[model samples]
Target: MNELLSTEEKRAVIELLYQLADDDFIISYRGSEWLGLAPHIEEDVAFSSISQDTMGHAAMYYQLLEELGEKDRDYLSHARKSNERKNAVLLELVNGEGHYLHEPRYDWAFTVVRHYYYSQAKKVKIESLKQSSYPPLAAAAVKISMELHYHLMHWTVWFTQLLNAGGEAKKRMLKAIAKVEAEFEDVLSLGPLSKEIVKAQLIEEESRLLLSFHANINAVFNDLSIPYKGEFTSLSGRGRFGEHTEDLSEALNTLGEVYHSDPGAVW
Candidate 1:
């Protein structure tokens, strides 16, 4: 029989899983809303695939949570309180000032940079999880890591193409990079439980993992002849500390509406 997680291990595992699940869930929700509004038809198709992958990753995380005795995956996902959510603010932010439905002047460059940076971070985390001592999670990580190939490739292409496109696209891309850099430390952080998770061997050391992340981004920028400045900006507050934006509240309202209506009602 497989070894079950100890009590402390279970708590640690749940913390990590909730972060993973909620981050993907909220981001994918926004991505889904953007389906028909993308700049180009071909790009829209490609973008939808990314949203689907994110949702799929969320589902995988939810399944793991279910095995750990959370409410049914759907209920836990859709009915959770705003404070209960563990996703970063960046993942929950709205696409733009206006609603996604009408007259929303979404910027393609921001989308590319945001998705590219986040996807790369997700890949790094998943890679670390593949070696997690928790058997079920490690197995799931292996499966999730497989699909990242397309995701990383797709975002890389977009990141490079638009950066090279020049003009407005380049301006937009640069702005997006600035926005992403502002909040990046949050993504790299594992929150207050970082030390515990590291001790549990649930993932690799944060510093080492972050180094790998920087190396990957540096390589990409170098290939593009973009000067690789090690500096990253963070105009926004630290999201890993549970601080959030109004966008997160709005997202929780929509995502949890159906689930909150009848969290106890069997679906």
Candidate 2:
């Protein structure tokens, strides 16, 4: 049987879980919105796998939250307010101009850079969570770590292929990297509760995890002969503290539209 946790411990665990869960949820939703819009059919299939994996990870975190006295997973996920969401704004941003169903001009370079940068950060966090004092979360971390190898490899391949493709591809990839760097700080922040979360051993210190991410991303850039600043920036506000852009509001509208129609209905 599981032992009872103090209120503080529970809150830390729950909040950390929310951050992780919301990050995956929003990124996967954006990925799903890509659907038939990927640059090539083979990549479409591969990218879908990453999206499904991310969503599956989000579902796992939601299940953990359900066990902690939160509302049912469906309600908690779909019924939350925009300000309540903990996802980074970069993840919430649309793939490109125009609607997903309309004449969308999606940029593969942006897609590759964003996924590559975010995946590296997530891998670092999951590694830290493997030692989480919250037993359930630590166990989930173990499972999450197992799946990240494939996710990292998939994105790494895309990142390198684009960088090495030369000509227009390289130019676009560099531009995408610049854009990702602009919004990257949101991914690294642990919010106002960072100290508490670290003290409770729910996850590692944000700085340490950030270092790991820097090394990982640096190696990728080195191999591609691309220049990388040792640090990341988030000219945009931090999402960890609930600072979000209008993109997130639009995302919530799309994700919750069906669920809100008949909120009281069993279906």
Per-candidate TM-score against the hidden true structure: 0.93, 0.96
Query: Residue pairs in steric clash, candidate 2?
Result: none
lDDT of each: 0.81, 0.86
User: Candidate 2 on 63-117: residue-level lDDT in tens?
Assistant: 9999998888888778988788787777888787887888988878898889989
In model 2, the Cα lDDT at residue 97 comes to 85
Q: In model 2, which range of ten residues has the least summed lDDT? A: 1-10
lDDT of 1 by residue, 1-267 (tens): 123667777788888888889888888998887888988899799889889988998998999888888887887678777667777767777887677776887766777888898888888988889999887788888988888878889999989998998998888888888887777777777777888888889998778778989999999999888886656544555555567777887877876777778877765
Model 1: lDDT equals: 0.81
The TM-score of candidate 1 is 0.93
Q: Give per-candidate clash totals.
A: 2, 0
| Native-to-model Cα distance after best TM-score fit, residue 227 in candidate 2, in Å | 1.8
